[model samples]
Target: MKELYFRAMDAIHNACLFVAGAFLVIIVLIIPYGVFTRYVLNSAASWPEPLAILLMIVISFLSAVVCYREYLHIGVGVLPAFLHKPAKSFLGWILEMLMVATNLFMFIWGIKLCQTTWHQAIPEFPIITVGLAYLPIPIGGGLTVLFVIERFLTQKFFSEPEPETISQLTTE
Candidate 1:
């Protein structure tokens, strides 16, 4: 059961990471295109600026989830490095629990934020709702919770999981 859950969460986490990476690439290409069209062609481009901002939101939140999962999120490693294994693991649990709390806040308030703006449309793209732009907040938060839960179930919250083999690293 735990293995199944791990696989499921890993799949979701990978999908979000891929989507965020795609958003980054899209913004890189599209923003330059927008600038060229507006300045060189003297065209009034309506979509690029707003689209870039939207993609940025997705990238910001989704990358955070990935970073936390991979043990790459910023922290004061100096202190933890000196501690015994039990103490280090205890501290890690505390920090992760705090993160879970923050995620919960985001999940709750983000939905409210989305609801508040759901009916409002963006000036750049009339069809896109303000809520749609805000979707990443809660989705990211919720996905983070899923990942944290998985970490706990897999014993990763208390201790570092085994280092991955080459294929394991690339497949995800």
Candidate 2:
């Protein structure tokens, strides 16, 4: 089970990296094209600005999921640091639960928003509906929620007991 979880995490991490790399490629190509069209041809590509914005949004959200899975989200941890070990663990559990609930809420709301915009087309990209543009919100949020739940369960129940000191655990 632990191996399976690690495999799943690796898969998610790889997928996120791929998405980010693609976004970078798209931006690199689009910017040059946009610049050439504007400076040389005295015309701009109609799609570049909006497309770049969409790509940025997707990349940011995808990166956020990776961060969440790694417990890399920024927080002021002064309170947690001051607490005793048992209390700190309890607080961590509660914090994880709250994060899970919040992500779930975002997932549900994002899906509803996408559904509501399903029939509405973009002004410039008429073939692509607003729903498609906004679809990443729900999808990314869902992935984040899944990763958080997996981490919560593993930490709260499945993980091995912690050692009294970091040095003790690390020593050969």
lDDT of 2 by residue, 74-112 (tens): 755788768888887888788777877887888899899
Q: Report every candidate's CA lDDT.
A: 0.82, 0.76
Q: Write the per-residue lDDT of candidate 1 for residues 50-114, one digit (tens) a residue.
A: 89999999999998887777766676767777888898788878877887999999999999999
Tell me the lDDT of candidate 2. 0.76
**Which residue pairs in candidate 2 have backbone atoms (N, alpha carbon, C) closer than 3 angstroms, thus clashing?**
none
Strongest candidate by TM-score: 1
